[model samples]
Target chain A: MRGAVMHAPGDVRVEDRPMPTIVEPTDAIIRIAATCVCGSDLWPYRGLEPVAAPQPMGHEYVGVVTEIGEAVREIRVGDFVVGSFFSSDNTCEICLAGYQTHCVHRGPGAASGGQAQYTRVPLADGTLVATPGQPDADLVPSLLAASDVLGTGWFAAVAAEVGPGKTVAVVGDGAVGLLGVLAAKQLGAERIIAMSRHADRQALAREFGATDIVTERGDEGVARIKELTGGLGAHSVIEAVGTQESMMQAIRATRPGGHVGYVGVSHDVSLPGLELFFSGVHLHGGPAPVRRFLPDLIDRIWRREIDPGKVFDLVLPLEEAAAAYRAMDERRAIKVLLTV
Target chain B: MRGAVMHAPGDVRVEDRPMPTIVEPTDAIIRIAATCVCGSDLWPYRGLEPVAAPQPMGHEYVGVVTEIGEAVREIRVGDFVVGSFFSSDNTCEICLAGYQTHCVHRGPGAASGGQAQYTRVPLADGTLVATPGQPDADLVPSLLAASDVLGTGWFAAVAAEVGPGKTVAVVGDGAVGLLGVLAAKQLGAERIIAMSRHADRQALAREFGATDIVTERGDEGVARIKELTGGLGAHSVIEAVGTQESMMQAIRATRPGGHVGYVGVSHDVSLPGLELFFSGVHLHGGPAPVRRFLPDLIDRIWRREIDPGKVFDLVLPLEEAAAAYRAMDERRAIKVLLTV
Candidate 1:
């Protein structure tokens, strides 16, 4: 088997590696059909996060189950499935409460190291959601998106309490943020505002149901949002950028008693309690419990109700993972699909 | 009129001040029947908050309306009323959303300078909620509690979504925190854990329906709460202490997907974004919109269903405001009531 590995920052190589096998009685082996480079992957690739060793490079995938341990009952071999970035037993108290990402028995190994020919999925019965039937080739990217990005964006919208009569402002233009606009629309938001400076991203945002676009960043961005919302700020703000400036802007761009749903992984961000307190907005987000939304997302994609696959503007073979990483790091692609 | 003024930290004195009169078309003048020292007041008294000049020192009150401007509608002269710390025009969009404290036309003058013989209240119809009728003398303290402490506590419980089958942890033992225990109980929480070290407060907590009391602080307090909840933390945690330790404790004590309702007046607190993100709890709070809960709280107090006024352990005449401040400063009294 061949998989992408990072030896250091800015260096990704696809080389022959040992194939993954079911390590737990609940695990299953999947032949990777599709995978992608995620925004989180850039954290280490850009040297912002440490590269400890030659580490496996992906945590998003849609694949066909090749083998399953005896304990895996719900997921059987030959079924095409989508799995989240974190594997969970799905019966733990936390997962039952809809926070599968923090499930007591959550293990990242199952869904990670997936940019390869084969990968292991732990807690298979709980983590993988099969489509109604084999999905068409055109629907592959969207289903793969349900594995992480689309579900994550949907979670961010839900966390923000985006619903009918809400004015939603998205704080990032990445794939997740673009999908957030789609989620807000699907959730019946009255207005969707995309904060993006790039012409291409703005067009995609508009295509995804954005009613307005603001290119400003920082305090100016907050002020613009307030201006658009009659000086009260948006009813819901999705923060997909985890920088200090973006977080503060998201908080400030929400009206009192509004909600700020942040999904971007935090870096050196420190939130001033005084500001957050006075803002009077509900704050909720983390590693989104994508597993919780996978089934519904897959259904939507299978039904062709949403086209989240549009986020994949670039696609490359698995062996060209290095180019995929560079394209993402340089902002040349919103998301890149890697075909195995 | 005589009012309590703080010339500097710890320098509270009863002094002659101009009698308050209606200054806005919606203003009403009230003869102060009762006022009290709040935990927030202790911030300035303890030199934690700056006292730039001789500032009039109170924001809570229950009194008889003496006069009303032409625009005042709901409140009438001779009506006994309970008002929150901030006056808001209840019809505004923000107020209608149940965040009166952040109402667009909010004015502090209507509620502040209340530790005096007479004070003017702005937005009278919105800020002051009249009791069903004039109440007996015994109910005055409880009514006063509804003006701020009880209402704030109620807001915290509501924000934390304290409801049936949930485990609630209260992080402060002051008047508001004690009232929060009562609120949680009234909200149908199956188990209420009151975190406190003071025996007197612990007793009050138990009386307010605390199912368990943890005499631990910081990490130990969080650990005790988790241990009580099968190591998953509480479903709802109310933070009524503004310090960094109390804030972090409240966040860390809530389970993933749980809620943390913090109503403390935040001071010098910085939250590391990464830790808060990983905690995966819903954070909602700030200076509670007490006005939103004033009516219900006053009704409960009127029916004698609750006795939040027990927190006022000391009472004194208006002229002895200095001594009242001292008792609260030294922790000799949980709260102090001043009568005019």
Candidate 2:
């Protein structure tokens, strides 16, 4: 099996590797159908996050179960399934409370790297959610999205408490942020504001149901949101970019009693406690517990109620994984899909 | 009129001040029966928070309305009232959403300094909640507690979603934290953990309905909380101390998907974004929307359902305001009550 591995900065390669096998009683081997590059992957690729050792490259996937350990009960071989970047027992108190990403037993599945011909998944019964049946080829991309970005955006919207008559502001124009707009719209937000300067992203944002677009960044961006919100700021704000500037913008753009749902992998950021305290907004974030929303999102995608697949602006063969990373790294794509 | 002023750190004095009058149509003047020294007062007194100039010194009080502007409709001159540290026009959208502390029309009532012979309250109809009748002298201290500390503690409990079957942990042992324990109990939390090092404070915590007590601080304290919760963390955490250490403890002590309600006046604190992002706990804070809880708190105190005034261990005449500040600053008193 050939898998993508990063030897060093800007040096992602598709190389022959041993096929993954079920190693634990609850494990399953998945034949990758689709996977993609993520914004977070750029951190190490750009040398901002050190890759001291060769590392396997992707964490999002939609696949078919190829084999399962004897103890794996719910998942069966040849079943189409979608799982989050983190695997969980789902029965633990934390998982039961809907924070499967922080499951004590399974740890983060990102390190297993899904952008491969085949990958082994532990805690299979709890991690993977099977589709009603084998999904059509067209629905594959959308299901793959539910494995991460789409589910993440949905979580952000839910965390921000987007609902009827609420104004939601999205701080990033990336795939997650754009999908957050779609999620907010679906969640019944009265107004969705997408802060983006890029014409392409702006157009997509509007198509995804953004009622307003602000081209400015930083303080200007917050001011614009306040201006649009009648000087009170948006009732809910989604932060999909994990930078100091984006976090501050997200916090500052929410009303005193609003909520800020952040999904970006924070890097080099420290929030001033005094400002956050005085902001009087609810803050909840972390790695998205995408597993919590997989079923509903899959159902929605299957019913054609949403088309989150559009976020994958560029699609390529799994063998061209390096190019996929480059496309997203240079901002040539919102998200890249690598079909196996 | 006479008022307490902090001319500099540790220099509180009772001096002649102009009589407070109704300057705004929505204002009402109250002749204070009781005021108290808050934990936050020590910040400026200790010079940790600079006192640029002589400043009026208190924000918690229960009083009788002595004068009302023509436009003050809901309150009358002879009414006994309880108000929060921040005045609010409860009709604003924020106020309507139950975040009156962030009301748009009125300024922070702290500037009016309730530790005086008379104080002008803005947005009188919204900020002042009249008691059913003039209370007996014995209830004065309890009503004054509702003016700030009790209301703030209640807000913390509400924000933390304390209720039946939930486990609540309090991070500060000051009057507010102790009252947070009381609030959690009143809110029907199944268990309350009070983190306090002092024996007296721990006793008070137990009296306030704390089911468990941990005399640890920092990481050790968090470890103890986890130990108590079977290696998980409390479902709800109240952070009544504003230091970075306490903030992080509050966050780390909460289970994933739990809530941390912090009301301490955050000072010189910066929360590492990565840690907070990964904590997976709901964070909500600020100067509490005390006005939102004033009515219910007043009713409860009036009915003798709770005795929050026990927190005030030292009582002094208004002229001994200097001693009250010193007693609180030196930790000689859990709280200081000043009678005018």
Which of the numbered candidates is closest to the native, going by highest DockQ?
Answer: 2
Q: Which consecutive 10 residues in model 1 chain B have the weakest lDDT in total?
A: B106-115
Tens digits of lDDT, candidate 1, A56-150: 88989988999999899999899999998999999999999999999998888344498999999999988898888777999999998888889
Regions more than 4 Å wrong, model 1: A109-112, B109-112
The TM-score of the first chain in every model comes to: 0.99, 0.98
lDDT of each: 0.92, 0.92
| Residue B58 of model 2, lDDT score | 93
For model 1, residues B177-219, the per-residue Cα lDDT tens digits are 9999999999999999999899999999999999999999999
In model 2 chain B, where is the ten-residue run with the lowest total lDDT? B105-114
The true-versus-predicted C-alpha distance at residue A33 of model 1, in Å, is 0.5
Total residue pair clashes for candidate 1: 1
lDDT of 2 at A113: 76
